[model samples]
Target chain A: MMDRRRGLGRYGLSLLRFWSVSLAAQMEYQLNLIIEVVASIATLAGGLFTLSLFYAHGQRLGGWSWEEALVVLGLSTFLDGFSSTLLRPNLGELVKQVQNGSLDFVLLKPIDSQFWVSLRNWSPWGMPEMALGFGLVLVGLVRSGARPGPGGVLAALLLWACGVAILYSLWFILAATSIWFVKVWNATEVLRSLVGVGRYPISAYPPALRLLFTAVVPIAFLTNVPAEALLGRTTPFWCAASAGLALVALICSRLLWRMALRHYTSASS
Target chain B: MNHQRSPAPEPTTRPLQRIPMRRSPLRIARTLLVSQYALMVEFRAEIVLWALSGVMPLLMYAVWSGAPAGAAAGVNPQQFARYFLAALVARQFTVVWVIYAFEEDNLLGRLSPLLLQPLPLAWRYWAAHLAEQATRLPLVAAMVLLFVAAVPAAAPPLDPMRLLLALLALHLGFCLNFLMQYAITMLCFWNERVSALERLQAIPQLFLSGLLAPLELFPEPLRAVALHTPFPAIIYLPAQLAAGGPIAIGPAFLNLFGWLALLLPLNLLLWRAGVRRYAALGA
Candidate 1:
C-alpha cells in the first residue's frame, strides 16, 4: 500500500511537470486566448439560435421542453470543450508520433505510455468554452427550476464523469488505431461529426437513428443521460448501465493500446 | 553557306529560336484537371473519409423529420428528407478547403515554387478542388443512391431543367466559396496561424449555410438576413432547387452571381497585394 502511494505521488508530480511545460509553450501565443474566447462565444450563440428555431412556434423536440433541451446542449458543449482541451491536443500528437515513428521514444520513457500520451499537453484555449458551458448549464437549471439535492448533485457529477471517461476512451481507441492505419487522422473527424448529433436530445432523432446513437455510438449516454441525471429524471438502471459502459470502454481502450503496440513497427522498419 | 561551315568548326553561338508554345485556356484547364485528378485518385481513402464527415445535413434531416418544427413550418417529413439529401449532394460538390491547403503551402514555403510557374497560382488550387470533387463523385453518388433506396421519399421527381439549374448553382456556389476562402487565405502572408480564424468563420457558415437546418424553418427576419449572406447561396439555394422546393430560381441565381462578382475581384486584389507583401518578407 505504501509503495502504491509512492507510485501515485510520482505520477501526480509527472503530470504537473508535463502540464506546466505544455502551458508555458502554449503561452507564447497569447493571442490565441482572445481568438478562442470569441470563437466559443460565437459558437454558443449560433447553437442557441439553431436550438431556438425548434422552439420558435411553441414546438418541443421529442417532448423535451426548451430548458431541458438546453441542459442537453450545455452538456454537449462541455464535452466538446473537454475534447478540445485534452483529447484533441493529446490524441492529435499521438497520430503524429505514430506517423513519424516517435512512439519509440514515448514507449521508452519511465512513465506509463497511455498516461503520458493522453496527458502530455494542455491547451488553455478550451477553458472559455468550458466555463461558458457550465454557465449555460447553471442557467438552464435555474430557468427550469429543478433544484437537486446533494445526493442528486453527486449522482449527476458521477454520471458526468462517466460521460467524460466514455468520451476519452472513444478518442483514445480511435487514436490507437493509427498504429495500423497510419492515415487515420480523418477518422477522428468522422467521430467529431457523429458526436455533433449529441447537441440535441437523443430522442429528438428518428427511432432508427436514436437506436444507432445509443447502441452503436453511445452518444446518448455522453449528453442525454448526464442531463437526465442532473434533472433527476434518470433511473437507477440507466445510472448503472452508464457506469458499466464507461468501465468497459476504458478497459477496452487500454487493451486495444496494448494490442496496437504489439503491432507497431517503427518508421525505420 | 559559310555559317554551316563555321558551325562544323565549333557550334559556339547557337541562334535563339522561338519555341511557339500554344497555351490556350482550354488546353491549360484540361492539363490542370488531368494532373490534379491523377493526384487526388492516389488519396482515395482520405477523400472517402472526408465525404463521410459531411453527414451533418443527413443528421439534421433526421431530427427535423421527427421534430414538430417540420409540421409547424408546413414541410412534411418527405420534403425534409428530400431537401437534406439534396443538401448532402450539394455540399459534397461545393466543399472548399482552399484556406487549409493554402495556409499549409504558405507556411511550408511550397507556394514560392508554384508562384514562379507560368500559370496563375489560383488555377492550380481551383483545378485541385474540381479534381477532388470528381474523385468524390462516385462515393457521393453511391451514398445518395443508398439513402434514396432506404428512404424513397428523398428521391425527387425527374426534372431535367431543375437538374441542370441545380448543377449550375452547385458549380457557382463552389466558385463563390473558393474565392471567399482564398481571399481569407491571403491573410496567411500576414499571419502564420490563420486557420483558427477559419474556425470563427465556420460558426457563421454553420448556422447560416443551411447545413444544420433548412432556411425555411428559420424565423422570418433571420431567414431574410441569411438570404443576403453568401452562406445560403452555398448550400440552401442549390439544394432547395434540386429538391424542388419553393424558391425563386432567378433571384437565387442572381444572388450567387452578385456574390461571385464581389468576391472575384476581392480575391484578385488580395492575391496581388499579398504576393507583393510575401516577396517583401523574403519568403
Candidate 2:
C-alpha cells in the first residue's frame, strides 16, 4: 500500500511538471498570443453574425427559437475555442514532428508517449479562450431570458464535460490514425468542418441529418444537445443518451489509441 | 543544317518531324502531369483527404440557406442557391494544391530539379494542378449538376457563350490566386514557420474570396471592400455570369487580364529575388 501511494505521488508530480513546461512554451510569445485571442474572438463574432442574419427575418430557424439557437451557437463556439486552444496546436505540431522523423525521440522518454504528446504543449494562450467561452455561456444564459437555475447549469456542465470528452475522443482517434498514416494533415481540415457545422441550430437539418449528428459524427452532443439542456429544450433521454455515447466513444478511442501505440512504427524508418 | 548532318538521311528523316507530332507545350505539360500523377499514386490517401476537405463550403452553405424563406438581408433564398453552388464550383476550380507543392519544395529543397528544366517552374506547378482537375473534373461536374437538378429553380442558365467567358475569368482568377500565393510563399525562403503564414493567409481566402457567402451578403464596408478586391471577380463574377445576369463579359475579362498581367510580372520578379536570396544563404 505504501509503495502504491509513492508511485502515484511520482506520477502526479511529473504530470504537474509537464504541464508547467507546456505552459511556459505557450506564454513565450506575447504577440502570437494576442493574435490567437483576437482570432478566437473574431471566430465567435462570425458565428453570431451568421446567427443574426438568420434571426433578422424570423423568430426561429427551422424549429429552434432565438434563445435556444443562441445557446446552441454559443455552446458550439465555446467548444470550438477549447478544441483549438488545447487540441489543435499540439496536434498540428505533432504532424510536423512525424513528418520530420522527430517522434522517435519523444517515444524514447519514460513517460507515456500519448500523454506527453497530447498534454506536452498546453497553450497559456488557451486561457483567454476558456475565459471567453465561459463569458459566452453567461451571455447565453442572459440571452435565453431565463436565469440559469442551478440544476440547468449543472446539467449544462455535465453535458459540456461530455462534449469535451467527445472532442478528445475524436482527436485521439485522428492522432491514432497518425500512428499508421504519418502524413495526415490533409484530413485534419475535416475536424474544422465538423465543428463549423455545429455553429447553428441542428433543427435546420432534416431527421436524416439529425440521425447523422447523433450517430455517425456525434456533432449534436458537441454543441446543440448540451445547449438544449441549458435552454430547457433537452429531453431526459437526450442527456442520458449523450452521456452514454460519450462514454462509449471515449472507451473505444482509448482502446484504439493503445492498439495504435502497439503498432506504432518508430520513425527511424 | 542539322537535317543535312544525318548519314543515310531520307525523305522525312528530320528527327524532330519523325518524333511524335506533340507540341512542345503539350509535351512539357504531359511530362509534368505524368510525374505528378506518379507521386499522387504513391500517396493515394492524401488525395482522398484533399477531396474530402472540400466539404466545408457545403456546411456553410446549408446553414446560410436556413435563413427565412423570403429575402433576408437583401439575399433571397433563390440567390442563396446560386451563391452556394457557384461557390462550390469555384472552390473546386481554384484549388492550387499548395500543400503538396510547398511541402516537397520547401522541406526537401527539391525545387532545383524543376527549375533546371526548360519549363517555367510555375507552368510545371500549374500542370500538376491541372492533372488533378482532369482526374476530378468529371465527378465534380456530376456533383454540381446533381445539386442543380435537385433545385431546378436555382439552376443558372446554360449560356454556353457566357460560360465560355466564365471559364476565361476562372482561369485568370486562378492565375491571380497562384501569383498571390507564390509571392507570399517566397517568405518561406526566409522564415521557417511557413505553416503559420499559410494558415493566416488561407483564412482570408475562405472569407474574403466569397467562399463562405456571396460578397453581396457581406455587411456594408466589408461588402464594398470585397467587391473592389480581385477575389470576387474570381468567384462572385463567375457566379453572376452563371446565373444568366447580363454581366458585361468584356469588362470582367479586361479587369482579370489587367490584374493577371501585373501580378505575373511581380511574381516572376519575386521568384528571381527569392532564388538569389535562397542561394546566397543556402537554406
Candidate 3:
C-alpha cells in the first residue's frame, strides 16, 4: 500500500509537467495555432453533420436513437482528438528515439519511464475537443428531455474519468513494449485502428468486434459504456463493469510497464 | 571526302532547342523509372505502410453495406462498394510525396541548393514527383490488371478512349492534391509543425472527400454542399471512371483544372507571404 501510494503521486506529477510543456508549445505559435483550432472545429462539425445524415435515414441505429449515438460519437471524438493532439505526435517520435539511442536520456531521469513517456508533453490545440464533447452532451440531454439527477450526473462523470484512466493505462502498456521491440510502430497502429472502431456505439459492432473492443483492447469501455450511462440508458452492470474493467486494465498495464522497465536496455550501453 | 560525297546529300532538320544529343522523353522516362525503382527498394516498408491508409475504411464500408435494403443510408449496397473501392484504387494510383519533400527541404535548409540549379525549380520539382509516380504506376496498373484477369466476367469492358481519359483525369487529380498539400506544407516556413494543420484537415477530407463514404449519403443541405465542393473531384471522379461509370469526362477535367488554377496560384502567394514572415523572424 505504501509503495502504491508513492508511485501514484509521482505519476500525477509527471502528467502535470507534460501538460505544461505542451501548453507552452501552443503558446509559442499563437497566430497559426488559431487556424489549427478552427480546422479542428470544422472537422468535428463535419463529423457531427455526417452522423446527423445517417440518423435522418432512421430514427434509431441498432437500439440507440440519433442523439444517443451522437453522445457516443461526440465523446469518442473528444477522446481521440485528445490523444491525437497530445499523444499521437509524441508517439511518432518513439521509434526515432529508440532507433537513435535517445531513449537513454529519458531513461536516466529518476522517474517511472512509462509515466514520463505518456505524460511528457501536452498539446492544447485539442482543447476544442472537451468543449465539443460537452456541447454534444448538452444537445443530447435537451433532445432526450431527461435530466440526469445529481446521482446520475455524478456516476457519469466518474465513469468518464475512469474511462480516460483506462485509456492512459492501455497506451502506457503498449508504449512500454517499444523498450523490448523497436518495430512496434505497426503494433501501435493496430492498437489505434482497433480503438477507432469504438467511435460508433459498441453495440453497432457485431459480437466479435464488441468482444475485441471491450475485452481485447477494452477501449469501448473508454467511451461507449460511459456515454451510455449519461444518456440514462446505463445499467448497474455497466458502471460496475467499467469501473472493474478500469481496475483490471490499470493493474495489467502497471505490471506490464514494470516488466518492460526491467527490460529497458537504454538505446545505448 | 567520303562524308561530303555520300552522306552530305541529306542534312537533318533542326529539332526544338537545337540539341543533337538530348535524351528522348520516352527513354528519359524509362531511366527515371529505373532509378526510382532502385530508390524505393530502401523505402519499401514505408511504401507498404503508407498503403494501409486505404484499407481502414473498408471496414466501415462493410458495416454500412450490410444494412438491409431500405435501412441502408442514401447509397445503395452496390454504389457504396463502387465508391469506396474506386476511392481505394484511385488513392493507390495518385499519391504524391511533394508536401513531404517540400517540408523536408524547408527543415533542412536545402532550398538554396535547388534554386542554384540551372533547371527551372518548379519543373525539377514536378519532374522528381513524376519520376516516382512513373515507377509506382506500373505496379499499380499491374495489380489492377491482375485483379481484372482474375474475374474476366466482372471486369469493366475495355474502352480505350475512356480509359485514356480516366488516366488523364487521374493525373490531373494528383496535380490538384499535390498543389493543395504543397501549399499547406510550404506554410511550414511560417510554422514548422504544419503537419498538425494538415492533420486537422484529415478527418474532413477522409469522410467528406468521398473516400470513406459517398457525399450522396450525407443528409440534406450537406449532400448538396459536398457535391458543389471541390474536394470530391480529387478522389471521386477518377475512381468512378475505374468502376466503369460514364463520367462527364470533359466537365470533370475542367472542374479539376479549375481547382489547380485556383489553388496553385494561391499557394504561391502563401509561399511568398510565409517566406517573408520567416525572414522577418530571422530564419
Candidate 4:
C-alpha cells in the first residue's frame, strides 16, 4: 500500500508538471494568450446575452425560469470550456497523430498513454471561461433562490464529475476510431454540435428531442442533471444512474483505447 | 515560330502564373466546380452532418414556440416555426467557411501558390462554395420537406412570387456573406490568430442575423440596430420573404443588392492589400 501510494503521488506530480509546461509554452506568445483570454470571456458573455434576450421577451422558457436556464448555460459553458482547454487540444489531435504515426511516442511512454494523450495540453486561455462559468453557476443558484443543503451540493459535485467522465469517454471512443477511420477528424465537430443542445434545460425541448438528449446522447447528464441538482430537483435515482453511467463509459473507453492501440500500425512501418 | 526555337528562358515562378493563363477563367471554374461536386458527393454523410450543425434556429424555434409567453412577443407557434424553418434553409445557402480554409492556407504557407494563379484567389473559394451549395440543395429541400411534413401548420401557403423573390435575395445574400467573410479572412495576412477576430464578428452575426430569433422579436432598440445592419439582409430578409411575412419586396431586393455591390469592391481592395503584405513577409 505504501509503494502504491508513493507511485500515485509521483504520477500526480508528473501531471502537474505537464500542465505547467503547457502554461509556460502559451505564455511565450503573450498576444495570443491575451486574445484567447478575451475571446473566451466574450464567448461566455455572448451566450449569456442571448439568454437575456430570450428572457427579455418571456419570464419562463419551457418550465424553467431565466435564472434556472442560466444555471444550465453556465454548467454547459464550464464543461465545454474544460473540453476545449484540456480534452480538445489533446484528444482532438489524436486523429492526426495516428495518421502520422506520432502516436508511437505516446505509446512508448511509461506513463499511461490514454492519460497522457487526454491531459497533456492545458490551455490557460480557457481560464477565463472556466472562471466565468463557475461564477455564473453561483450567481444563477443565488438568483434562482435554490438553497441546496450540504448533501445537495455534494451530490451536484459528484454528478458533475460523472458528466465530465461521460464526455471524456465519448471523446475517447471518437479518438480510438481514428485508428481505423482516416477522415474521422470531424468527429469532434459532431460532439460539439450535440453538446450545444445542452445549453438549455432538457425540459425545454420537445418530448422526442428530450428523449434523444437524455437517453440516446445522454447530454442531459452533462449539464441538466447538475443544474437540476443545484435547484434541488434531482432525484436519488438520477444521481445513482449518472454515477453508474460514468463508470461504465470510462471502462468501455479504456477497452476501446487498448483495442485501438493494437490496430495502430505505425506510419513508419 | 522563331520564339519557339529560341532557347527557353530560365524557369521561374513567373512561368507558373502564365501556365494558368492557358485555361480560360470559365474553364478553370468548371473544372474546379466538378471536383468540388465530387468531393461533396463523397462526403455526403459528412455534408448531412454539417447541415445538422445549424442548431441555433432550431433551438430558437423551441424556445419561442413552446413558451407560454411567446405569444406576447407577436410570435405564435406557426409564425415562430415558419420563421426558423425558413431561416434554416436560407442559412444553408448564406453560410461561408472561407475563414477556416484561408487560415489553414496562410498558416501552412500554402497561400503563396494560390496567389500565383492568374485568376483571383476568391474564384477558387467561390467555386467550391457554389458547388457545395448546389450539391447540397437536394438535401436541403428534403430537410424543408421533412420539417413541413412534421409540422403542417407551420408550412405556409406557397406564394410563387414571394418564393422567387426570396430565392433571388438568398443568392445575393450568399454572395454578400461570402465576400464579407473573404474580406475578414484577408486579415490573416496581418494577424497570427484570426479565429479570435472571427468570434468578434461571429457573436454579433449570431445575435443580429435572426439566428436566435426573428428581428421583430428582438427588443425595440436592438430591432432598430439589426434592421440597419447588413447582417440581417443575409438571413432575416430572405427568411421573412420565404415565410411570406410582411416585407416590402422592393426595398429588400435593393438592400441585398446594395450590400453585394459594396462588399465586392471592398473584398477586392482587401485582397490586394493582404496579398501585398503577405508577399512582403515572404509567405
> How large is the C-alpha RMSD of every model relative to the true structure?
4.1, 5.2, 7.1, 4.8
Candidate 3: chain B TM-score equals 0.72
lDDT of 2 by residue, B1-283 (tens): 1133324455774664343434466655667788876765676567666666776656665666665622556666667777677767777777775544765687787866656766567776777777776666766777777877876656776779877877777777777777777777766667644555555556556666767666555668776665656676667677666766434566566666777788788888877887788678764
**Native-to-model Cα distance after best TM-score fit, residue B130 in candidate 3, in Å:** 6.1
Candidate 1 lDDT, tens digit per residue, A78-155?
Answer: 988999999999999999999888999999987799999999999888889988989888889989899888988998
- Pick by TM-score: which candidate is best? 1
Q: How do the candidates rank by lDDT, highest first?
A: 1, 4, 2, 3
Return the DockQ of model 4.
Answer: 0.46
**Candidate 2 ranges with C-alpha deviation above 4 Å:** A1-8, A23-31, A63-70, A91-114, A124-130, A180-183, A261-269, B1-26, B69-79, B97-100, B111-120, B145-156, B219-221, B245-255
Each prediction's Cα lDDT score? 0.90, 0.71, 0.67, 0.82
Maximum-lDDT candidate: 1
lDDT (Cα, tens digit) per residue for candidate 1, span B1-283: 1122222334556665444466578877888999999999999999999899999998988888888877988999888999999999988999899888988888888988898999878899999999999999999999999999999999986899998888889899989889888888888889978888888877898899888888888888888888989899899988998899888788778888999999988988988998899889984
Order candidates by TM-score, high to low. Answer: 1, 4, 2, 3
TM-score of chain B of each: 0.93, 0.80, 0.72, 0.86
Best candidate according to DockQ: 1
Error of 3 at A60 (Å): 2.3
Task: Give the distance in Å from residue A111's predicted Cα in candidate 3 to where it truly belongs.
Answer: 1.8
How many angstroms is residue B133 displaced in model 2 relative to the true structure, after the best TM-score fit? 2.8
Task: Single out the weakest 10-residue window by summed lDDT for candidate 1 chain A.
Answer: A1-10
Candidate 2 lDDT at B145 equals 78
Clash pairs detected, candidate 1: none
TM-score, every prediction? 0.95, 0.83, 0.79, 0.90
Can you list each candidate's DockQ?
A: 0.80, 0.38, 0.21, 0.46
